[model samples]
Target: MSVFAGRFDGRVAVVTGGASGLGRETARRIAAEGGAAVLWDIDPDWLEEARKDVGAAHAIAFDVRDNAAVSSAAAETVARFGRIDILVNSAGITGATAPVQDFPVDSWLQVFAVNTHGLFYCCRAVIPQMIAQGYGRIVNVASVAGKEGNPNACAYSASKAAVIGFTKSLGKELATSGVIANAVTPATFESPILQQLPQSQVDYMRSKIPMGRLGDVRETAAMVCFMASEECSFTTAATFDTSGGRTTF
Candidate 1:
């Protein structure tokens, strides 16, 4: 009955940041469609909760920024699920908002660590497996901010922009292979990250979107699910936008 009905039957999916927000929603959709899922997150408490909610998916407490830990997690996932058909790099941090000159070095580094380095680590860990199997779908979660830089959020914007470029390069590299790599740029979504911002900042974000609203996590997850499905055969090296008309280009 679902448009994606049985599209992922018997496949295995690994979702970083699967404990919350878009990642959690995406994992649930994958599981509902009959794929075995591996949920990776740094928060063990929330990870367990999500595991129970998803019902039968594997949950692992591993920081995506830690390359060695990510590699080990990938191995464990393959051991448990046999093969990883879909990899969603959804773990990220919205670092401090400030002018570039006033931005703290620590905050900048942390943003890059989680948003950029962590994504690369996961890709490195998973690409070999995908290559060996000659099949895989990779969906990296970027942001509309990456396309048009947001004032006072230099680090977050830069990191996400880097993800877009990284996705493009990697997608081209794996174009000939059966594997597909793409990134999604979603605007302000109803997620925990909004809680960290001041009311004024949040209001400003919402006002910028022509749709006059924040995106729902489920909507973003739906797009991700489609990209990760076997039905997504010909669309690689693309950046899908779910920015509520905030991005006209």
Candidate 2:
């Protein structure tokens, strides 16, 4: 038997944006520890890839922005897995980087649609199920940019900052309950999302981190897994930093 043989044997986990980046890595780790994972993503192609990678997990091609879709996915996940024990809100978009004056209203809206509203939708869908079970672990993926706003990425920064606030508030709301909620703020990590940015912009982001290097998605995933694990019984409503010395305190 594996070391984590029964660490999460009967638990069900849902990872939004589980097709790639930190979400993919988190799902992979959870499965390795014997948890059943429900991978939710809009990318059908990558969703297949993630399913093959996770083995025995369910994949749902759903957009987090649609309330009904999110609700349906959550319901289906519970039907398949029996209970929702963990949730990682990882679906997010880095909106167009530009000055506030040049920022497009639609772009800003899109950022919030995924980064903030999407998270809320997932939480709304899953919280009752968690409450029913009297146990749940939630990890919201925010960014160091959220903690200390980043220039040229107003929408992305603001949306993530709102996520942090939301996590804190929900954590408190469930403080007396058995549910635990927290957010992880990572510095720039090596992920496919970086391909969307210009070289100069990427370099600027790298320069801001005192660690002088980008974080690995696995590192971020590890922190997230720890928070989601039963081992983390305390430490709710906190912002756990994996920012590599960026935005310290």
Candidate 3:
């Protein structure tokens, strides 16, 4: 049963990275609350399964790193759903764990390509639709490392910081346009993304959290859902922190 029944009764949400992790969790919550979630991910097989699990209105598999693909997906969504009321940019990657001096240039670029540029593409493609409709909510999933850089994880840290900066600029630009944009900074969390990192790196992150525990995806999803809701009326261009007390600012 939905705790906030009818909160998203008529809304349509487009969630990137919806195949797994926080994206999937958020989509599940939105659908439970009556929103028509449209799941987007780079994996078609996983995307199809998630579409059934989340009860999504649609599921499209495409690379967010490709602006043309992102644009096409946005148009397809508008064509089928009539309008997009929310966008949750949850697609990201954790590049190879290495010191700045040893970090592979290719790894750094790929991280930015997905974690930063992919997000930009999604926002660019969808914002026009939101503007035409006079209302929309955008929640970009950033990271606590973005605020305080993590050792040996230079690319992920820098890319997320860029996400925060980009969100601020976009929020200000759309402030008066009836489209609200915000970013969420989460601490080390129990997520599939963690699997991409080595145990030592994970342990290092866990050590930094004052709470001494990884955040549950549900906790972060709760924050995202609220920000995606019409109830988030007064906040825009702000960073909502879910860093388990790791980041107070």
Candidate 4:
């Protein structure tokens, strides 16, 4: 609600992982601002809740890891909304914490499957539609861990790092296409994702932040909404920090 109502009037946005956490906040913001938000999540129960929470334009339960699902969902969204002006890739998983040498191979693969490959699939599916429409904004959620590797989070770090690189390349490719792509690197936040990490690791992350506090999803959502808005013109293939001064570069 920080953004003025009608700022995004007549717009349509797609938020992956919009069932909960940062994604949910972003979706809710878009809807509150007179825009339509399409929420995509893998959990049907949460999807139902999110639909109510955001008055979602559309809610679909499908794993982002499934290439076919992402493709079909993109097509369905375009059909439902007529055009999608914003895309927020907010779905991700922080794999079980462990040192690189001891990180279970299965866990590593699963992390990449969702974090790296899944994002790739979503972007691949949606970019064509955006290109066709001749106007779009894409915001990929990455992490500070991607920039400064956190101890015992090898897979999560690597996956997000890939997201950063992917966004940069995609942004360049669409530079002149009236479509822009960028990635946001956020510090630790109080969200469902934190439940997946070890308490000690969480404390460690918090201590590292100069602000000595975890970020709030509301705060992250503020930055995300701006990035997805027309006000973000001239910024693409860049990394934005919602890291509480943890990242200055």
TM-score of 4: 0.98
Name the weakest run of 10 consecutive residues (lDDT summed) in model 2: 1-10
**lDDT of residue 180 for candidate 1:** 98
Worst window of 10 by summed lDDT in candidate 1: 1-10
**Candidate 2 deviant stretches above 4 angstroms:** 1-5
Clash number for every model?
0, 0, 0, 0
Best by TM-score: 3
Q: Measured by TM-score, how close is model 3 to the native structure?
A: 0.99
TM-score for every candidate vs. truth?
Answer: 0.97, 0.97, 0.99, 0.98
Tens digits of lDDT, candidate 3, 198-221? 999999999999999989999999
How far off is residue 40 in model 4, in Å? 0.6
lDDT of 2 at 216: 96
Residues 1-249, model 2: lDDT tens digits: 335555777788999999998899888888888999889999899899889987638999989999999999999998877899999999999989889999999999999999999999999999998998899999999999899998999999999999999999999999878999999999999998888677787899899999899999989988998899899888899999998898876
Output the number of the lDDT-best candidate. Answer: 3
**What is the model-wide C-alpha lDDT for candidate 2?**
0.91
lDDT of each: 0.91, 0.91, 0.95, 0.92
Could you give the C-alpha RMSD of every candidate to the true structure, in order shown? 1.1, 1.4, 0.6, 0.9
Ranking by TM-score: 3, 4, 1, 2
Q: Which regions in candidate 3 have their CA more than 4 angstroms from the true location? A: none
